[model samples]
Target: MPCVKIDMIKGVRSPDEIKHLAEVVQEVFLDKFAAPNRDRYQVITQHEPYELIFEDTGLNIPRTEKLVFIQIFQQGRSADQKRALYASLAERLEKDCGVPGSDLVISCNRNEKEDWSFGYGRAQFLEGDL
Candidate 1:
C-alpha cells in the first residue's frame, strides 16, 4: 500500500489538477512497482505560500510557486523500481499537468506490511483482511 501526501502552494493548482496529479502518481506505481489496481490511496494538502518553504537544497535547481512535494508511505520496493517511478512521474506530470518535473519533489518512507491498518481496528495486511 502507498499512502501519498501531496503538499503544494495554495491556488497553484485547481482541484481538478490535483486529482490528475494523484492519478499520474498511482499509475506509475501500478506500472513499475506491481501495485494492485485497486490500491488507490492519495491525498493532497494545500498550504498558503508562507506555510511551505524550501530552497535549492544544493541541487542548485530553482523552484517556483508551482512546487509540489510528494511524500509516500509504503512497503519496500526495489531501487530500480523507485528510479523508474521517479522518472515516469517527472515525465508524465510535466507532460500531462504542465507542472515541470523540476518543480516536483518526491520522498518515500518504507515500512513492513504489518505497519498498515486498513480499517475496523485491524492490521489488514497482516491479518489477511486485504
Candidate 2:
C-alpha cells in the first residue's frame, strides 16, 4: 500500500484538489504496483505554511508560496516499480495539482511481509475519511 501526505499553504487547500491528487496516485499505483483499487492507499493533506515556525533559528521559511511533501509506503513492489511510480507521481502531481516538481518532495518506503498491516484493523483506505 502507498500512502501520500502533502503539506501545503493554507490558501492552496481545496477538497477538489485533494480528490484529484488521490485519483492521480491511484492511477500511478495501478500502472506500477498493480493495485486493483483505490482502497489500497491513504492520502493525507496538511496545511502547514501558515504554521511554520523558524524565525527563532534565523532560518527563513517562505510563506508566500507552498512546499508540498509526499511520502508513500508500499510492500512487495520492486525497485523498478518504485522508480516508475515516483516518476509518474511527480509528473502527474505537478500537472494535475498545479504544484511544481521542484516544490514537491516525494519519498517511498518499502516494507517486507512482516513489516506492514493492510487488512482488518490496520490501515486500509477508508471512504468517508476523505
Candidate 3:
C-alpha cells in the first residue's frame, strides 16, 4: 500500500477541486506505481499562507501560492516505477488539477512491510491479513 500526504496552501482550491486532485493522484499511483485497486490512502493538509514555505532551491523555478507538496510512503518500488510516478503526477496534475510542474514537489520514501498496521494494533502485512 502507498500512503500519500498532500500539502498545499489553504483557500487556493475549492472543495470539489481538492477531491478531484486526490482522485487524480490515486489514478497516477494505480497506473505508474502499480498500487492495487481499492488500496488508496491519502491525507490532505491545507496550511495557511504563512504556515507553508517553498523556495526554488536555486533551481530558478518560480513558485506561487499554488505550490503543492506530495510525500509518498511506500514499499519497495523500482526506480523506474518511481520515475514514472513522478512524471505522471506532474503531467496529470497539470492537465487535470491545474497544478503546474514547477509548482509541484514530490518525495517518495521506502519502507518495509512491517512498518504498517492497518488496524487492531496488528501488523496486517505480517499477520497475513493484507
Answer with 2 or 3, whichever has the higher lDDT: 3
The candidate that wins on lDDT is 3
With a 3 Å backbone cut-off (N, CA, C), the pairs that clash in candidate 1 are none
Which 10 successive residues of model 1 have the least lDDT summed? 121-130
Q: How close is candidate 2 to the true structure, as a TM-score?
A: 0.69
How close to the true structure is residue 15 of candidate 3, measured as C-alpha lDDT?
96
lDDT of each: 0.85, 0.65, 0.94
RMSD of each: 1.1, 6.5, 0.7
lDDT (10s digit) by residue, model 1, range 1-130 = 7788889999988889888888888888899778888988888899999998878789988888989998988787888878888898889889988878779898988988888778788998877777
TM-scores, in order shown?
0.94, 0.69, 0.98
- Rank all candidate structures by their lDDT, best first, as comma-separated numbers: 3, 1, 2
Q: How many backbone clashes does every candidate have?
A: 0, 0, 0
TM-score of 1: 0.94
> Over the stretch 1-130, how does candidate 3's per-residue lDDT look in tens digits?
8999999999999999999999999999999888899999999999998888888889999888999999999998999999999999999999999999999999999999899988889999998887
Please give, for residues 1-130, the per-residue lDDT of candidate 2 as tens digits.
5555655556675778877776777787788778767445565656556563223134343423546667777667778887887788778887887766656666777765455446565533332222
Model 2, which residues run further than 4 Å from truth? 50-64, 118-130
The list of candidate 1 runs beyond 4 A from truth reads none
